[model samples]
Target: MRSIIAFFLFIFLIHSVQAAPLLQATISRESQVIGNDGVTHTSVFQERMYRDQNNVWLERVLPKHHQHSTDAKNKTSHKHLDLSETAQHYFLDNKKSTRLNLVLPEDKTVIHLQTVDIEMLGLTNCWTCVFSIFDSQSVKKMKITQQGNGYTWYESQNAKNKIKIKWAKLQPDQNPHPTSEYYATMDSIWKIHLERICRLWGLNLVKE
Candidate 1:
């Protein structure tokens, strides 16, 4: 009789847990990276990600806008070659979070890290799962204020150059995929890179 009662209780617990939805957060950030090589890079990256303590995955396409690079050695001519790409990323916690395995099925890449790392945004992950704390707002590790549609963030400021590294997070129900609007935005930012396509279609970059 005790065994029967315990079995029913266990079943009830499982059903109650299943009824609760997973906790997911979307983190979006736009900022400039000042390289030690004396070059600055501007990137606008948005990610729609999912996480529930132990499981995480890239659900949909996240928008990305990255301006090309420059080197002080080549500062005279400053060649900017913007690039655009598409991919997906997923991760599963296996006993530990620091020893998580990052899976980029789209690019056929898997990384087994020794420790939790919070670096290289919008590059390594297919879409964006979690790069240490990047997928979470706590990644900022700095003070922020409530902004119009999102929270204003800044980890540091370059007073000499008058540039304050800023970031923001906007919560929206819409998931942006590889839609026409996305292409138009990328097409404008990378006009030179997409010159061939623009020429073929005889279309000009939309200028605001």
Candidate 2:
């Protein structure tokens, strides 16, 4: 009876971890930002962190059809975040709060954009997951582009200049795929890096 109980407990724990939503960072503070041009702008940003095991599998949120279908077979389905509505859906379902809303920042001054790349976890089909954060908002918009070394986030217009604040890549490449382990590693690294960024910006990660 004791062994049976222990085995059931272990299985239950594993399932709980696997069932959780993908982990991510949350934007938590806002302030008035004035650029060098003397234009007053709104600085929007949230604290960022990686979600634990349950959250790491959030990639599955993408339609199963897109995941299973070939590029040509589901050309239309692959069009996920390209549309604003789709992006909005993702943002809402993530459950993390933002520091600001639809209000556009006041000043339009161009701010220098910097990027950090980290390896992604749980993606057997792709090589890299580019996690990008904007200076204007805390929500980190992620684009899972093709996997390869030639990939450059700084050059992509979709990753626009000015508003971009930071970047982190999570790499996971293995044949036959080690999805869970890679996802956990990526989450751990992202959480640590995000905490460091918050400290540098004088933001309180968990407090708000």
Candidate 3:
């Protein structure tokens, strides 16, 4: 009787370990057109968060360039992106959203609240891969294309300031599927931008 009880207990523990619940989440994205002239602009904001799970959020925002200018005295030039003096309001959900502004001026009119179909990246809830039973190979191999608006926002010295947004609809290295190719290709592109942005904003993404 004792031996049987111990055996059952061990089996129950094993089952419990293999049957953990998956994390639930909600992801959203948005875009905006700014500046009075509207000739130069930026858009594209994305957010990912867990709804049923603990509070976790990741966000990325991009603002457009308004106008480019140069300083006469120093012969140095700077691009003056346009903005009102209001914080731009972007609704991520029915009750949740965020307010964002350009980084340079730090004080300007924010793009107002508007209904825009900003392409947001939705997280794949694949926590089950922790269990040996769940097939995680597909998640690793399968690729999805996230199509949406893209833009560049920056401030630079007049002579060297050249901003261009180059995004790949597909990647360089060929994949069995076109979709999968961009998956591997996008990392390098994103890394370059992230590094540049961090340097320009005086922010250290990786801790020393």
Q: Which ten residues in a row have the lowest lDDT in candidate 3?
A: 175-184
Q: Name the regions of candidate 2 deviating beyond 4 angstroms.
A: 1-15, 19-39, 48-50, 56-152, 158-208
What ranges in model 1 sit over 4 Å off? Answer: 1-20, 23-26, 34-40, 58-95, 107-109, 116-208
Residue-level lDDT of model 2, residues 1-208, one tens digit each, is: 0011211111011212233233454434444544577776654333333333221111112333433223655442323222111111111113442211111011111111111111121112111222232221222243333334433232122322222222344445211111111111211211112333211222122200
lDDT of 1 by residue, 4-75 (tens): 121211101111112223433444444555567767576654444443333343333333553224467744
Model 3: residues with Cα > 4 Å off, grouped in runs: 1-94, 97-107, 116-208
Deviation of model 2 at 155, angstroms: 2.8
Estimate the overall C-alpha local distance difference test score of candidate 3. 0.24
CA lDDT of every candidate: 0.31, 0.24, 0.24
Q: Please list the Cα RMSD from the true structure of every candidate, rounded to 1 decimal place.
A: 18.4, 21.2, 21.3
Ranking by TM-score: 1, 2, 3
Ranked by TM-score, the better of candidates 2 and 3 is 2
Evaluated with lDDT, which candidate comes out highest? Answer: 1
